[model samples]
Each structure stands twice: as structure tokens, then as C-alpha cells.
Target chain A: MNLIKLAWRNIIHDPLTLFLNIILLTLGIGLINFILLLNTQLKDKFEKNLADIHMVVGAKGSPLQMILNSMYHIDAPTGNISIQEAKPFLREKHPLIDKSVPLSMGDSHKGYRIIGTDHTILEFYNAEIHAGELWNNLYDVTIGAEVAKALDLKLGSQFKSSHGFTDDVDLEHDHGTLTVVGVLKPTGSVIDQLILVSTESVWAVHDHDHEAHDHEGHEHGDHDHEEHENGHAHNDNEEHDHAHDHEGHDQHEHDHSHDDHEHDHEHDHSDPNHHHYGEIAPRRKVNDLSREHLLSQTEKDITSVLVRFKSKTNFQALNMPRNINENTDLQAASPAYEINRLYDMMGTGTKALQLLALLIAIVSAISIFVSLLNSLKRRKYELSLLRVMGGKPAKLLSLILLEGLILSLLGFFIGMIVSHLCMSAMGDSLYERYNYPFKAWIAHGKEGLLFTGTILLGLTAALLPAIMAYKTDIHSNLSEG
Target chain B: MLSTKNLSHSYKGTQAFNFPDLLCQPSETLLVIGQSGVGKSTLLHILAGILIPTKGEVLINDTSLYKQKTNALDTFRGQNIGMIFQKPHFVQAVSAVENLFLAQTMANKAKDTKRVHTLLDQLNISNRATAKTYQMSQGEQQRLSIARALVNNPKLILADEPTSALDDSNCNEVIQLLKHQAEAVNAALVIVTHDSRLKDIFPNQLELN
Candidate 1:
């Protein structure tokens, strides 16, 4: 009965035009929303996992790949550095170091990377064992909440791991079956999708001296597997014997009193000439220690070392990574620097997509204008009749304005729904592929601005048409009709 | 009551029109008869406050219409004057009853569905009240327009050639309907038309040359 009611009638009089306007506007707004939601979540995930890790120490390669591998677990490691090479930073009492967790990767279960680190990794993720207990020994595995849910792993479950990062089941390492000791609670971090095991477990899986490896008779010549395996055995021996063999591989074979064991281990370990720290722990003779064991503990190499500074304000912390990069063979990469570089790379695509979405919105506004203008011309006499029925010129103007607003609002709502629908669809595939969570409904400040812009677009498009309705010559139109 | 004096209008590059003075009391009916292009519609528009005459005043209840601002004039017209076009036009999307509701609402009057139903029932078009305006026949549309004009209970009703498009019998029926509605509301009625038949029906008549 009011101007708005009349405008509603006028719009519904031609539903096709309204539908067309809504579809175009929805597509534009939906695209904008989709891009915004993705970018926000991606940046958030990157920033969250980049928490407090000042530097990544790894074998020389792409720094970004190193950070991506160690911090986010999204890429392959940049080869491994020997324990001796990483000794200073890993030392508990080192001046610049607060804590250091070593990671030994290059294995996967159904494409989810199995990360090998100490108990500190749980603290790093702020994770809790929601069920059962954390891994306590070699071959004892604890899965992330997401990994447990996705792979349907449970307490007391056992699964053999495959060698290297691959989805193929054919490359299964028959060395040992990792027992599921725990399932961590959801931390909303990258830890949710990781399969966590002790670094010793990683070395044990590759260790040849284990009876299981002899039973399998697999050639242990794969250096990546063998070096990492001895590191695992040394870790085991440290746990039982308190040999404190945290630094060198010689005490590993010397403790077993195997000169034959020393022969194979010495082949790789003796290239570096240095004092064997593990041999010093047992007060073993220098003649019993191999030179290779002096450079690396257990003759093993780990993927990377995650370093936390004693204090961020410490000057030594600032100088340490640089010294590691310039003076040592190992490379240092900062998660913050590499992630910012990633954002810079993705920013251009986001901006271009945003522009395209805005252009679609503007074009939809034009369609609204045209549709209203067309309706106005057809309803000219009807409008004149309204004037004759004692409607003010302003009333007629408001009628057209209301119609435009209704169309815009309808289109905006439909656009939001469409965007979320697309997100849900894309989110499912993305989760399946990369384990990235994309929630359907995510409202932000930018969307609020988008709503305001939609209203403005609607009202602005109606301006000329409303003015035309206002200036309509009631006398002429009535006479002609 | 309705009155007009020295009412004149001129279109750009066209001849000027000079209208005779007029006066009518409440419940009075007047017909201004003219040929096409005699500015009969122009006179009706001026009386309805839809057009501003080049010279003169249209006084309703002795208040000069031309003396008011555009907004005030519009409000005054909405509340006091009801107009029926030559053709029975409407907001075609709405129902016949809704058309009456529109008239009441536009005049800043509260909706009275009871009164709307009563008016349509009185006009004998209550059966078609819920039907869209386009669905109604010609005579039904005209009667609905009459119902709309009377819905607001205005002080004056100005209809332009109400019978011009109707047959002989339909024309007589429409005139009787308009007169009865005007008398029922106690309003002055001024109808301008080129139809000669109306002159026989209305004793208060003015002829435009």
C-alpha cells in the first residue's frame, strides 16, 4: 500500500529481469568473497606455523624450500646435515639457544609426512594427547588429530611406513611397523595433519643392525636410510645406557665392541677429522673412534634443526644464524622471511581477481539501472495514474528507488550464498589435496564494506531513474493515456 | 466547493487557452463540453492542481491553489482532489481492491479494508476486487477507477472524459455511478469531455469552443 509495496509489485511484475540482475551480481560478489576467505585463511595458517622459530638450519639449498619443509611440512627437505655440523646450535647450554628440536623426515604414510622430533614438538604445537599417550620409544608413533581422524587411526593401531614422501604403497619400508601410541587433540595448526614420532624412531626404521632389517635383507646401501638409521640406534643406546652419545657415531659401534660394525660406520664417518664427543662421554680411547664418528653422531644426518633463541632481544641470537650461513656448511632460513616472500607472490593474483569481481559488481549495477529504466518507460502511464491518485512526485521517485534497492539486496544475498557454496565445494577438494580447512561461512570487516558498497551501488543506479519518475508530466501522461 | 477565475495556459509555440470562470458547491455536478484540442483536459489538470496556469487561481474552499508551494500543493491535492483519467489506468500489478488501498495510502489516509470492500460492493465490482487491474473488463476498470477516486472521500472529484470510450448504455451507467458517488461523499464533481451525450445528463454545463 506504501511506495515500497508498490515498488515490490513493479519489480515482481517482471521477475525475469530481477533474476538476471541477481545472477550477475551474485557471481561477482561470490568471487570476491571466495578470494578474500582463502587469502585470509592461508595467511593465518602460514603465520601460525611460523611461530617463534627464529631460524631453520639445514643442508644448503633453497631457503624457502627449507622453511617450507621444516616449518610448514609442505615441501621436500633440502637434504640433511650431519649431527656434528649442527652440534653447536643443538647443544642445550649454547649461548644463543633456548631450545632446539631435530627433525628427521623423508618418509610418509599415505602422503602425510611423519615428523621425527623430541617431546618438545608437542609443546611447540601446544598439543595435548587427547587419547592414549605420546610416543616413548623407537617405532612408537603418535598421530595428529587430523591424521587420526582422516586415516581413522586409533590407539594400539599399527601401520608400516613407506620410504620417502610418496602416496604409493609399493615402497613400504618393511623394517618395522609403527605402533600408534597416541592421538593428539586438534591444535588448528599444521601439527593437526602430522604423524609425530621420535627422531630415534626415524633412525630405527632405517637402522640395519636391527634384527628386522636382517630378516628383510634389504640392501642398506641407501645412505639416506642408513645414516638416519644409526642415528636412531645411537638415540636408543643413549636412552638405555646413559652413554650421552648425543654428538658422535664412534661410541655407537665402540659400545657394541664391534670392530666389524666400526668398519661399515667408519666408511662414511671418518671423512671429517674432529674429536669424537660421544667417545669422550664413555672415556673411550681415540684409536677406537672413527673420524666420521667425530663429525657426526651415529653416522646419521637429520633433515633440519628448529632453533628457538634464548631471548629474542639477545644480540647473539641475531649473529648466530648469519654465522651459521656464512661460516658453516649448513644454511639458515627464517620462516617469517620465506612466508612473506610467498605472500608477495600470491598478492598479485589476489588483486587481479578482486578487480575482476568489482568489475562484475559494477556491471550488475548497470543492469539494475537498465532494468529499472526499462520498467519505468513501460509503467509511465501507471506512474501518472499514481500521481493522479494523489501521489506526490517524490512518492513516484521513491517507488523507483525502492525497486532498485530491492533488486540490489536480493542480488547481494544470493551472491553471498553462491560464494559460500563455491567455497564449500572448493574446500572439500582442497582439504582432500592439501589438508587446508575452508569453512563456508567466514565473515570479516571487508565483507561489511562489501555490503555497504552494494547498497550504494543499488541506490546510485536508481538515482537517474528516480529523478526521471519525479519529473514525469502527470498532465501530459494522463491525457495521452 | 471548487472555483476558478481567469484560468489561462499556453504551450510553447502553440495557441493560448483562456477558460471561463467557474464555481460549484459541495454535491454539485458540472460538465465542461469541448471538441478535441479545445484544452478541456488542460482545464481539468489545472483544477486538479496537477498543472500551474500561466494566469489565474483555482480556489478550493476559497484558498487559492496557485499560492501554495509545490509540495504543499501536492499534499493538498492528494488529500482534497480525486482524478479519473479518460482511460481507466491503474498500477496494473496490484489487485482492484489494492488499487483503492493505494489511493487511500497516497492521500496519507490509514487503510480501511472494510470501507474499501463496502465501496467496491456499492459499485457492484466487489466480486472482482481481488483480480489484477489488467484482468478486469473496460467497464469494470472504469468502475474500479471510480471506486478508487471515492475511496479517499475527497472534497472534489475531477474526471476527464469518463464516458468517451464507453458505449451509449455504458456511458449512462458510468455517469449515474459518478453522480451517486459524488453525492454520497458530498463532494463537488467537475467532468471535462468531448462526448455530447453528457450535456443532456448534466444541467450545469459549460461549452468550450
Candidate 2:
């Protein structure tokens, strides 16, 4: 029989001690590998979604929360700042700023955030439209890859928006269901989970909510809804006629949806804004999203403005947050700075877990050494019998060493499977909570070092026992037996 | 043939031994009897090529065992010598057939399953070939041990206290098996033990004081 087969036989025959050794080793390696997977993926995803944007300008509060809300979309916004105040940064070519995209949120569908961003977000994330075209009109929606897969949305699929970002079904907006005009390919960023539309869509939903306060009488509002469906009205005149229909009390239902049955889908209009852009009746002039719309709405606000500088060395880079924090009511947070702080705060817990895993590994090494040494004592006569026949001293030594090596390699593979299985078991709940998809198996180069280290550990543990086997007193052991 | 001349041994912390010269022709069995303090194991170790004597040489077929380098001497021992212990020690994790396989491979011989099975059948323990050594009764273990020793077709076979752990009936059965296997392989056999029951069985005997 070969030395390896002989060694394997020896290991399996003494199951209790070797089994304990393998269990400790599996737990040790499993925890270490699990931590590495979590750390790498968390760092990769956080860094990838940064997308080279330098500063986030929003209402002043916790700077970290502003960066998280604006860049990562994981937290409630600090507050909203006027769109007029962020206009200087959003201009086509400001001197210090490379580009800026304004974000307005506070609406969702089934826990996935619906963000009102224009084409700049698609350009910023380098996302391609996978199935259909980008939103051509105000309320038309372009869905992210993950959002489409999760919600089973498709081109021409329609769904109603909820008022807030949380997934409470009770807060569903009863006005109009948003239409999916496009789907974006997977970008491996936060954009993969968002439902994107023009900024006016968010304002229109809230502006309609605000118009319900101006309802004249419930009976008259119900009357206007019936006449709108019964009357043949053009898209431009429906809003003017819905003026009388707009004064609803408890039930602010208007049948403007019926007036848009003849709406066209062509995006070839020279005028950037379309008829349905302000197709809802305006209780006030601020709802006029026509030409010069943004200029006239001085009271309108956006949640945050994402700013990338023209150059890293711009004096603005050194002075931007400080300047904004001291002089303006708006807060400007650097994504890189805030994210590093987040990692440092998380590193303490990861370090403690890693230390525990290392301790388990050390204990496992001791157990392996003790187990091998114990087996060597019991197998002394057998080793001597080998020498009595034709075995060299080196062969006996290698046989002992091979047993330890074999057990350790087996434990390492089992530990790797354990780690991946654990990750997969935690995957669905983690995705439900944070919306980051974690796969069960992701291989990297670091495992190669782990393999070499395991071999070294096994050999080191077996060294003393193997030497004893090498030096076995053949005559004395055989005679003693 | 197996022979040893001037086979004496001594070391720093152990008693010195000056052994009688020994010679056994092919198909012959020799017995060396001794008390517990008479260095019976020492003589077996020197003759088995495991120990380099203070001053002596062991020969098998006219090739001096100790005259070769240490590694070559090991290969020579594997090719020429087989050993059996009194209590029938084995690599207990492996099967009886595998132990026989180990004997052949360790002795630098080609694997011969037919030779192994033939040796097992000759010992009349062929049914226990696939059983682990620990699973066998003491009598069956002793027979398997003999099968292992003869599997390599060695030039010299040494049995250390082979009948010391056996009853009178078992002792006679084992000694007969040893002599028959040695005659079958045409190798010289030597049995060293303090057991008096073996006195009448082997006629060529040496008693150490």
C-alpha cells in the first residue's frame, strides 16, 4: 500500500481525536473565510457606487447621513434645499464643478426606492438602456435591472407609486399609475435597484397631494369626474376643464386618466416639455412645468445635489466642505471621507471576529499536535514492526506526517464549503434588508495563500510526532510488544 | 543461506553482548534459546540488519550485509530478510491482505497477489485475508504474521519469540507452519525465544546463558 493510503487508514481508524481536530479546524477556517467574503464585498460595493463624485450638497444635518442618502440611497435625507440654491453647481459648465445631478426622492414601490433623476444619472453610472427607451415624458419611468427582476416589471408594465420610501401598502398614491418606458442594464451599482424618472414626476405626485387640500366640495368633485369621461376633451384643455374637477374634499379623484387615452408615445417633439408635463390641473402657478418652469418655481426644492469637481487639485477640493459648512445653510459632504469613517467604525467589529477565528485556529493547531502525538505513542509497536520488515526510518516519518497533512487538507475543503453555505443561508434575509445580492460562492486569489498556510500548519503540528516515528527503537518496541 | 561471524555489539549505556557464530543453510531451521537477560532481541536486531554491530558481519548468500552503505543496506535488508514478533504486531489499520502487500512492496518486490494468497492458504488462514489484523483471533493473527513474513520470498526469515504467547497446541501448530513455509520458500529460518515448549520441535538449537 502507498504511504498516503496507509496514512488515511490510520486517521480513520482513530475517529474521535481526529474528528475533534477536524471540527475545530473547520470552524476556524470557515469563520475566517466568511469574514473575508463579507469585508471584500462590502468594500467593493461601497466604493463602486461612489462613481467618482466628490461632494454631496444637501440640507444641513449629519454629513454621513447626507452622503448615504444622496450617493447610496440607504437613509432618510436630512431635509430638502431649494433648487435655486443648487442652480450654480448644476449649470452646464460651472468653473469649479465638472457636473452635477440633482436628486429628489421620498417615493417608492415595494421597498425599492424610486428616484427622480434625469439622463445625467444614466450618464454618471454608464448604464445602457437594455430593453426600451429612456423616459420621454415627465411621468414615464425607466427601471433598474434588479428592480425589474425583483418586481417583475417590463416595458409597458404599469404600477402605482407609494408616497414614502418605506414599503407600507396603505400609502399607495391613488392618482395615476406610473408606466415603465425603459429598463437599464446591470451596472453593479446602487442604480441597479432604483426606478428612475424625471424630477417633475416626484413634484407632480406631491403637487397633486397638495391640490387635494383645495377641494371645493365632495359632491361637485364627483360630478366633474363623470363629465370629463363623458366629454371629449383635448389633452391641453383637460387640465383647464379639470379646474372645476380639482376642488375635491375627502376623495380627490379626477378622471384625467380617461382624457389621456389618445396620448402619443413619440419622443420627437422639439419642445422638451410635453402636454402631460403639466397635464394635471395646477391649483397654483408653481405647478406650471412649461417653458421657464424651473425659473418661476422659487419655492421648489431638491433633496441633494451630487457634485464632481473639474480637477482633484482644484482649490475647491481643499476648501469646499469647509466653505459650505461655514458660510451657507447647505451641507456639503465628501463621499470618500464619510465612507472611510464608516469603514473604520466597522473595522473594530471585524477585527474582533478575526481575532476569535485566529484563536480557534491556534487551538486547532494544538489539538492536532496533541492528537498526532497520542497516535504516535499507540502506534510505536506498529512502526517498529515496519522497520523490522523493510521500511526505512524516513518512510515511517513520512507516514505520520502524511496523516496529519491529509486530515488538514480535508478539513480545509470542508471549511470552505461551510463558509459558502453560511453566506448563502444569510443571503436572502440580507438582500431583503439591504438589497445587496450576495452570492454563495465567490473565489479569489487569497484562498491560495490559505491553502499553503494550511499545509504549513499541518506539517508544523506533525513535526514532533513524525520525528519520534523516525527514531523508533525497533528492537525494544518489538521485544516489548 | 544465512550466516553471521563475530557478531558482537556494545553501546555507551547498555550491556555488551558477544554472540556465538551462527549459520543456517537453505531449508534449514535454527533455534536460539535464552533467558530474559541474555540479549536474544539484540542478536535478532544485529542479524536482521537493523543494528551495525561493534565488530561483526552478517551474510546472506555470501553478500556481507554491513559492508554496504546505510541506504543500500536498508534496500538489501528489505530484499533479503523477513521478521515476525511474538505478539503478532501489525499495521492494524490495514487488512491482512494489505499487510501482506506492504511486506512485498517494502521489501522492494513486485506486488504478487497470487504469492500473497498462496502464502495465506499455506498458513490455512486464507479466509481472514481481507480482515483487519485487530479483527483476527490470536492464532489467526500469528498465521497472518507468518504469511506477511514469507510474502517477499526473502533469503532469511527471523521469528522473535514466535511461540511465547501461544498454548502448547498452538505452539506446535505455529512451529510446524514456520518450518513448512520456510521449506516452501527454501529460505533459512531462525527462531529466538525463551519458550521451552519449542525445545523438542527445532533440532538445531543454541542455548545462551
Candidate 3:
């Protein structure tokens, strides 16, 4: 205890020296803390996004980009597949399949990406509605948390689609405004920056010209009544008015068109019982045609599929995904595997930073040694006096060592503080750019052990100077006057 | 009870002193009077075991001081001997009391605060106990050095030119303090000096020519 007191006194006596040491230590620890926190946050984000999905089935492209788009919701999708091609797998009920969510991307609302998917995507994400219920009909929209915040959007808010990736230009369909039906709670995922609508809505906007083309085709043929009954030839002005009413007006139009088609087809038949049968046949044909159109649309294209496994295994179920990519026309990736590989590639820089911290600590120790050694010469007579007055060499040695230990511990404490402040400042930017959450700095477990180890190293570095003090010849040095 | 017989010493291959015989009994102040360069300092160093004699033995209470190991010699010096140099060499960074405490530590004893204060009082410098060594006047530093020397109550007191840097009054005060300390410990006092001012106070004196 006395030795410690002496050490502390020595440091307190020299504020400039102590401050310099603190600065060096703070810089070293600050760099280490920044790197460590960044690495932790990146790994956390990757792992969180990796959960719930087993594999990504996407268009043949960079497997990394496919995983990035499908799992992280960043980057453009390779392209989309028709629902028909996705239906066989969806119907197969394979235990391994779990559930499939179809994602169609290409449009943007403000700067956030627009995801056109079915209600199944919401269910897959277990997304909670913060404002209203899920969209039940085409054109109804739900927005993620960041999308709502950035665009100042809320439930019932209307927004037009932008031309490109930004909200700058007016597009061809800028006249159409999508009403937001719900706002999703923040999930700390890529979903947070997205605007999700029904897949048909996406097809509806892009295929509006197709609707006009169908109208022209119907006018040329005897299917003019069929076109009106199919609900494709509604007045453009009435469609605009119905779009403003978010209360199932579109569904009502479909039902009315079905009833009119049934009555017309039945009248065309001569026999009454034949009329009943003709009405049923038309309904079946219409249903079959719509189903076939949906199936054919999704057949050739798929951006990606996220696969979740039944058991914890490393690349065990990778074969099917790889084969799909190599044999079939779609690409697959394991997010966990790819992310681990990415961490491995990044580990070198982290290791180098750790090495630099170690090196700086060592240099600091040597500096302590040199400082004490130099002080020994100036204190020779004083030391001799202590010896002649009955101070044992061991006690003298301890006093010198105590001084070194004090300096190092002070430096370590200062360094830790510096690291904490720096990380807190950078945390917001990291979340903004990478969707990562920053945790508080706490020296527990391995970090605590490292801190203690550094202090011990500092103490050990004082051993040489202590030995020099112990070897000083008291009788000879004192009587030399 | 300190004695040396046929003691001789050299520094860097040059002879510094050759003392045929010397002795100082308990409670006695034996002044070794000598001219400059007559080996007063060298003899004092040899007697204090600071320098190893090349030709003879230095015995303190029948123990051969030169034959002991370095660490043992240090321990023996700290516990049994007190040294006063021509100039007071206290640790400049520490206070006078701390210097005294250092002396007690060297002897492996608890700091005797009361004794240190009393010794400083006797030397008329007790007020300077908390003063840094560098801040103390030369006379006060010299007196504090003497106090530090006596803090462990050593059995043998060795002083080399202890009054050389002091005025007559301060010299008299230091001589009285050293004499009182030696008598209090029942130890032998050996003072080596070129000045003959202290001649009348010592009944038995060794004159080296």
C-alpha cells in the first residue's frame, strides 16, 4: 500500500508527463474500440438478417449480390420469376420448404425501395402493423419504419412513384398516388426502408399500357361485352374516382363484372338448363385463364429464395441450392456461410489493429523503464541516505516499481474512456448507413481480462529499474563525500 | 566499539590511505586531526565500510565488515552505522521528515517520529521538518542530515568534515548534536577533519601527519 501511495504521489507531482502518457494510451485504445465495435455490429446485422431463411433462389447472377438483395433488402434484385414457376414448390408442401415469399422489385417511393409482394411476405417477416391493418386489395400500400420517417408518410398518406432510384423526377405514372394502409414497426432490418404493396399492384402500374392494349384488342373483336365484364374497360375517370375510395371499391367492380358475364353467357345459350351450365363454364374459364396468366408470368424469372433449415448444419443443405444454380437457371446462396467468409477476409485488418495496440503498450512500458532509470541517477545520494538510515534494498526497489504501475493504470483508464466517447459518436452514422445497432461499451469478460493484463505488463516493465535500485551500494555511495 | 588495524586503501590504482591502527570506544568522540591530503576522508570511508581496505581488517563489535557479502554489508551499514558528509545530501524532492523516515526504513525499523523531532529540536531546526530539503538553509540541511544519520540510533557514528561548511556558531551546534547522539546510543563517534577547531572538546585525539 505504501509503495502504491508513493507511486501515485510521483505521478501527481508530474502532471505533464502523466498527461502525455494518457494521450498515447487513449489513442491506442480508441482505435481498438472503434474497430471492435464496428466488427461486432456488422456481425450482429448479418446474423439477424440471416435468421428465418434457409436459402435464396434468385436469377442467375453474383451469388453475393443475390444474398445481399434477398436477405439484406439492399441492391437491385437479379429479376423476378413468374408466380406459376413458384407455385409447384409452394404446393409441394415439402417439410424443407416451410413457406415461400415472392418479392418483386423495380420501383421506388421517395428514396426507399418499393417491394411488391403478397400478404405472405408480411407474415413471413412477422411484421407488426404500427398504424393500420395489412393491405387486402391491389394498390393498398404498407410502409416500413424508415420509409415512414424519411418520407414523412403515415397511414392514409398518398405518394406517387418516382421515375428512378430517387424522388427527384416525375414518372409516366406519377399521376397515380398510392394510399398507405399501414406503417410497420421498426424491425432493424432492410424491411425498415421499404414500401410493400401487392405483387399485382406492381404488375398493374407497369402493365397499365397492357390494359390499354387489351381494350384496343377487345374493340376489334366480338369480346367487347366480355372486356367490360372482365372489369378491364371501366371508365378512366371512374377508375380515378374509385382509387380515392380505399374501401374495397376495386373488389366490388370485380364482383359486378363477374355477375354481368354470367347473365350474358346464360342469355346466349338457348336451353334454360344449358344456360345454367354455360354460366358455370364461363366462371371456370375465367378463373382458369387468370390462374394460368399468373403462373406463366412467374415461370422463367426468380430474383432469390431464402432457405431455412430444419437442423443446425454447415453447408449440409447447400447441394440443392448449388445444383439449382449450376443445372437450372436460378442462383442460390447461404448467407451464414458467405457472411462468415466475409468476416474471415476482414479478420486480417482487425488482427493488425490488435497487434498495433499491443505494440504501443509495449513501447509505453519501455518508456516507463527509461524514465525511472534516468531518475535513479539524480536520486543516488538520496537513495544512499535511505540505505544508511536502514531502508532495505527490497523496499527501495518496490517504491520505484510502484511508480510505473501507477502510470500504466492511469493510461489504461483514460484509454477506455476515449474509446467509449468515440464509439458513441459514430454509432448513429453506422446505423444510418448499414442498419446496425450499437451496444454500450462495457469491460467485461475478455475485455476486462485484457485491461488487467495490460496493467500487469506495466508493473512487470518496472522490474529492471527496481533491480537497479536494489543493487545500489549504500555504504560506498553515502560515504563518498 | 569500532576499530581498524593496518588499514590501507587505493582508488583507481593509486594509494589513498594507509592507517596502521585506529580505535574509538563507546561514548567516546575520537577526533582524527589531519592536514589536507593526509587521508582523513579516505580513512573515514574505510572505517565506515564505504571502501574496502586493501591490507587490513575493519571490525565492528568483532565482526569483520569487509568479509561480509554485499547485501549483508548494506544491512550492517544501515543498522549499525551513521554517516555525515561534508555537505548535507538529503533527497531534494522530499521533506526533512521523509528523509528521516527513509533512514528508519533502511535500518528495517519503524520511523521514530518523536526521536526525529527531538533530534531536530536539539539541532535547533525542528521547524524545518516539513520543509523540502532544497528549501532548507545550508545549516538547517546539515542539521537535518545529522538528524537523519541518527534516526536509526546507530551504534557507530562516522562524520567527515561535518562542520566544514558551517559558521562557528552552527559548527558548535552540530558538534554538540553529534556528541549528544553518540552518548545517547552509547556508541563510538569518529570525526575526521582538517579543522582543529574541535580539538579542545576531545580529550583523546588521533593526529595524522
TM-score of 1: 0.84
Error of 2 at B204 (Å): 0.4
Q: What is candidate 3's lDDT per residue for A1-481, written digit by digit as tens?
A: 1456545755666677667666666666556655666666676678767757777776667777677777776556666553444554443355556666666665676556677665556655667889896665566788988788877987889876653344455442433357798999988766777788765455344333223223333222234233443444333343431222211223322334233322222111111111110000000101211323334443223334555555435454656677776777666677777677777877887888888977777777777777777777777876766665556678788878777777767776777777777777776665445534465474423466657876786678778888888887765576454
What tens-digit string does per-residue lDDT give for candidate 2 at B20-125?
A: 8999999999999988878788888888888779998899998998898876777788878888888888898899999998887776678898998888888888
Question: What is the fraction of true interface contacts found in candidate 1?
Answer: 0.77
Looking at model 1, residue A411 earns an lDDT score of 78
Q: What is the lDDT of residue A236 in candidate 1?
A: 35
Q: Can you tell me which runs of candidate 3 are displaced by over 4 Å?
A: A44-49, A52-54, A58-304, A309-331, A475-481, B5-20, B33-46, B49-76, B120-127, B167-173, B181-187, B195-204, B207-209
lDDT of 2 by residue, A25-137 (tens): 99988888888888888787788899889888988999999998888887777887765666665666678887778888877888888887667777678899999988656
Rank list by TM-score: 2, 1, 3
Superposition error at A284 for model 1 (Å): 27
Candidate whose DockQ is highest: 2
In candidate 1, what are the lDDT values of residues A311-348, reduced to their tens digit? 86688777777788899999997777778888888888
* Residue pairs that clash (backbone atoms under 3 angstroms), model 1: A248-A297, A249-A298, A269-A292, A270-A292
After superposition, candidate 1 runs with Cα above 4 Å error: A109-111, A128-132, A148-175, A183-186, A206-298, A310-329, B12-15
Q: Which candidate leads in TM-score?
A: 2
Predictions in order: lDDT: 0.77, 0.77, 0.65
